[model samples]
Target: MIKTLDSVSNHEHRQIIEKTGYKVETLRIWKTGILKHSISNPSNEQLETFAMNVDAVLEKSNLHIDSKNEIRANCTSHFLNERRRTSKQGKETKENIKVVNNIKKKIRDNNLTVVKADKGSCMVILDRNLYINKVEEFMNENGFVKLDNNPTSRLINKVKNFRVSKEFEDKFGKYKNLIPSNPKIPKLYGLPKLHMDNIPIRPIVSLINTPVYKISKFLSDKLKDLTEFKPTYSIKNSGQLAESLKNLQIRRVLN
Candidate 1:
């Protein structure tokens, strides 16, 4: 019985059962383990009937046996792997949705301008005046004197000069600010090490000409009529941007 089954393939088994008078649902149930028996466990008479039916079907279809076997094997492996990948992605997507929802809630509650949230990080847009005001308020509440003569102007200047600094020392480094020992007064000041250009208060017009930006803009334009979609701030490349747009469409359709 094992040798007889060893000669047959899954597609052949399906075709044989399909050719018989039994419904395709029965064959499907058997394949899904709902049925206690499989096509391989058929009686001798059933096997004979299956064989005759498969032969007739194959003859009518004029399918090459070798080609059929090769194609079936390749497709089976390809589809099975695809199924597994899709299942794994579905689980990851569910987790990501939860995270994104939480982030959105926080943003709403805090009135923060968070543009997007994905796997590792989120993108936020800050208003310069609002941030400066908050800093000034904190400084006033803490009784910290501004380093320069003009508090608001000096605070803005410091923020403008703030640079991305890396540290290499545990105690003291170039980026570390020095405080006077036994100081007569507490002072609020910007770091001396930060000497970079001010953060852009407006959009960089030059970026519109870049390939990545163009691609993202094109996709957004194309999908404008279908749904409202925009690229997330964290998207670095055209492919990632496109995927975000695609997800937007899927979400709209699902909703």
Candidate 2:
């Protein structure tokens, strides 16, 4: 039930619309609230325009939009829709999961392949035969051989059974941080770099899934602190490097 009070601010108007559904089932609510976002110069036309913006936002969010105003405050009406209590997330049934898995299996069975383009900004799809041919050609040109067996299991076992000396532990902390638990095989994918003279396949090996990833990360972080403000090792470009070199004090360094 909307009590027609004086004009309220736009923010207050949206709050009511968001709470109240197409029909206000609760008749017990008699409280009216106003928030001072700005000076409330109540106008009916402004309310209508504000409601249109609310509709756009709600629509974009995949939310229910109440086109008609059922609640009134002051002389103006504000749009309100009931919250969808039925809408839930992560409530998929077992049958739904099985169906989804089956669909995925079917897709994989057809020998479809995917790789991240620009590190997951998007994916580029190509013919399976063409992709394999390109990768094989690159490997052959580089004199790389394809291994007969998977080596991920062997690597994981080796890391798990590894031992560290006391002196090493004292300098670099514990052994646990240096080893990855349940490490997946490192993945390699190539991106067709278009900006190059010849669009070369820029081979990338995903280090995140490697057995020594944790050790690499720990060592990298420890070593990074030493290089924070070094004079010669500038990464920002040639201009920044020149500026940094100009500011270096060579006499003080020798002394």
What candidate 2 gets wrong by more than 4 Å, as runs, is: 1-123, 165-173, 195-199, 226-255
Candidate 1 C-alpha error for residue 134, in Å: 9.9
Question: How many Å off is the CA of 94 in candidate 2?
Answer: 21
Residue pairs in collision within model 2: 5-74, 17-79, 17-80, 21-81, 21-82
Q: What lDDT does candidate 1 reach at residue 99? A: 53
Look at candidate 1 and tell me the lDDT of residue 29.
33
> Which candidate number would show the highest TM-score if scored against the true structure?
2
Question: After aligning candidate 2 to the native by TM-score, how far in Å is the CA of 60 from where it should be?
Answer: 38
Q: What is the per-residue lDDT of model 2 for residues 148-212, given as tens digits with 9 covering 90 to 100?
A: 99988888888888999999899878897777666888777787433343334668788895898
Query: What lDDT does each candidate get?
Result: 0.40, 0.51
Q: What's the distance in Å from true for residue 251, model 1? A: 57
